[model samples]
Target: MLLHYLKSSLDDIDHLIDLTKKDIEDIKEANHELVFERTKIKNDLVKAFENKKSLLDNELIKMVSNNKGMDLESILNEEQKTLLNEMKIKLTELKSVNKQYAKFVVIVSEFYNTLLDKIFPRELEGYKKANRTPATLLKVRA
Candidate 1:
């Protein structure tokens, strides 16, 4: 039962990581649809894992603590250990990919801001009225 829950959680993380990778690709391609899809996937992933922390912290902890001084590795089966390790690796990859995506987003935002500034001119001097001299003929008529 514990292994089952752990595996399920790992699968969720894998799916999230896959979606994040697709998000990066979609960003590069400027695909709005795929980006929206990735957002939905991210929300679903968050909902799925929202309530599982207690199970991991309480139930899994109790189970793993039963083997005298033995750690989780000594208690878990070979397949379970392998799955846990794989989850860790996938998590690390996800972190790195997220960082790259964030950097790309920041660069794009800065480029957009610079473009807008050049076109719209943010400084007050750009909007100031031109100075002009009054005609002298109007004074003679008065």
Candidate 2:
């Protein structure tokens, strides 16, 4: 069961990496359909990965409770240890990819906001602005 959980988690990370890269490509190409489709799959994989990680953690805790003296390294076999290492590496890669995706999203948001501001200037709208209060509780006479 331990090995199964580790392998399944690793597999999820692999699929996530692929899906993330594909989404980046789709975003670059302006393929909305593929991007949305892959986003759903990626979200499902993320949930599965979280579930497998939780299962693995529970099993490890059980093992520790059962065997008071032994540590995790001693409890896991060589294969499980290798899979855990691989999982760590793949998770770092996934983090990097996710960072890229986040940066892209920010850029796109800024571009749209700038475009809207140019096309329809807020000053010309002649509408009363809301939320005029300061963010903090301090009162200023200026």
Candidate 3:
């Protein structure tokens, strides 16, 4: 049960990391609709990952209870330990990639906000940011 959960949890995280990389590319290409479309998938993956992690944790706790005094690392066999180490490394990579993606998103958002501000020229009232109205498209017949 322990090894099964361990492997499954690892797989879940790997999928999330893959999705994150793909999302970064989608953003770079300004395929925002695709990015938004993937959000539900990403969220589902995250929920599944969390569930696997919770199951893994329960299994680990049960092992500790059965053996008494032994910590998680001590109880894990070589294979389990290896899988845990791989998860740690992958998690680090995930954090790095997520941070990079976050920065890119902030830059894109700021660019759009600045452009809107220039176009709309918001009032300088006592608000932190300006309120924006919807932009309209003009269609003319030839």
Candidate 2 clashing pairs, residues 3+ apart or interchain: none
Q: Which stretches of candidate 2 lie over 4 Å from their true place?
A: 124-142
lDDT of 3 at 86: 91
For model 2, how does the per-residue alpha-carbon lDDT over 56-78 read when each residue is reduced to its tens digit?
99998998888899998898889
Clashing pairs in 3: none
Stretches of model 3 off by over 4 angstroms after superposition: 130-142
Ranking by lDDT: 2, 3, 1
Residue-pair clashes per candidate: 0, 0, 0
Report lDDT (CA) for all predictions: 0.72, 0.84, 0.83
Per residue, candidate 3 scores C-alpha lDDT tens digits across 1-142 of: 8788778878878888888888899999999898888889989988988898899889888888998987877888899899989989988998998898898899999999898776665665675655654443323457
Q: In candidate 1, which residue pairs clash?
A: none
Tens-digit lDDT track for model 1 on 49-111? 545545655765786777768787778788777876776797788789889888877877798
- Supply candidate 1's per-residue lDDT for 135: 38
Between candidates 1 and 3, the one scoring higher on TM-score is 3
The TM-score values for the models, in the order shown, are 0.71, 0.82, 0.87
